[model samples]
Target: MSAQETVALVLAQAPVPPQDPGGQGEDFGKSSPLGLVLLIVFAIAVVFLIRSMTKHLKKLPVVFDEEKANAAAPAHVKRAEAEAAKRAEDSEATETPEPEETSSKPSQAKTD
Candidate 1:
């Protein structure tokens, strides 16, 4: 009923058993080699899946044309071709060296 009486009653109760200091069960990580092998396999599969998806994404069409698939080039193929053509044009424009105009004779100054 009173705070002092409640405190005395709680203190009079027997304490619970002290638990083992060594908390870990002996077979913790050593439980299953099969689980580790499965985890490794899963990780490898995920890596392969990610790599395949990235490769597929890299080969994707930048532009779409349904008829192109029936023609000489597919949509993705045509997009790659267009990009190649653009790069070629840019390289050609930038790569060509401009010729310097040169006169064979130096101009002589006429003294009056």
Candidate 2:
């Protein structure tokens, strides 16, 4: 058989799909209320995640190199570092060394 005749026979034998009468299938291609609720929940989650990411990003230093960051430190950062250094110095200066105890008893030599 020729290709054209074979194709024609196959087309003739194909079953036709049933169509909705009077377009009564309104539910077709329509999302359910649950789907709408899920979409809203996902949007809210995305917004919260973005806010959290922004907060975390703000906590990060502008530069990872300490020398470079200090060289180009902004006024606020410089003030914060100064306060931290002062606090450390005060803590170290306020720490007291414990006094060592001396025993009054004399040591005796052991003979084997």
Best by TM-score: 2
**Candidate 2's C-alpha lDDT?**
0.90
The lDDT for every candidate, in the order shown, is 0.84, 0.90
RMSD of 2: 16.2
lDDT of 1 by residue, 1-112 (tens): 9999999999999988556545656664474888889999999999999999999999877777766655856679778888999999999989967797598888899999
| Candidate 1 residue pairs that clash | none
For each candidate, give its TM-score against the true structure.
0.37, 0.42
Q: Which stretches of candidate 2 lie over 4 Å from their true place?
A: 1-14, 19-25, 66-112
The TM-score obtained by model 2 is: 0.42
**RMSD of candidates 1 onward, in order:** 18.9, 16.2
Error of 2 at 82 (Å): 26
lDDT of 2 by residue, 14-106 (tens): 687668755659776788999999999999999999999999999888769978768878999899989999999999999999987587888
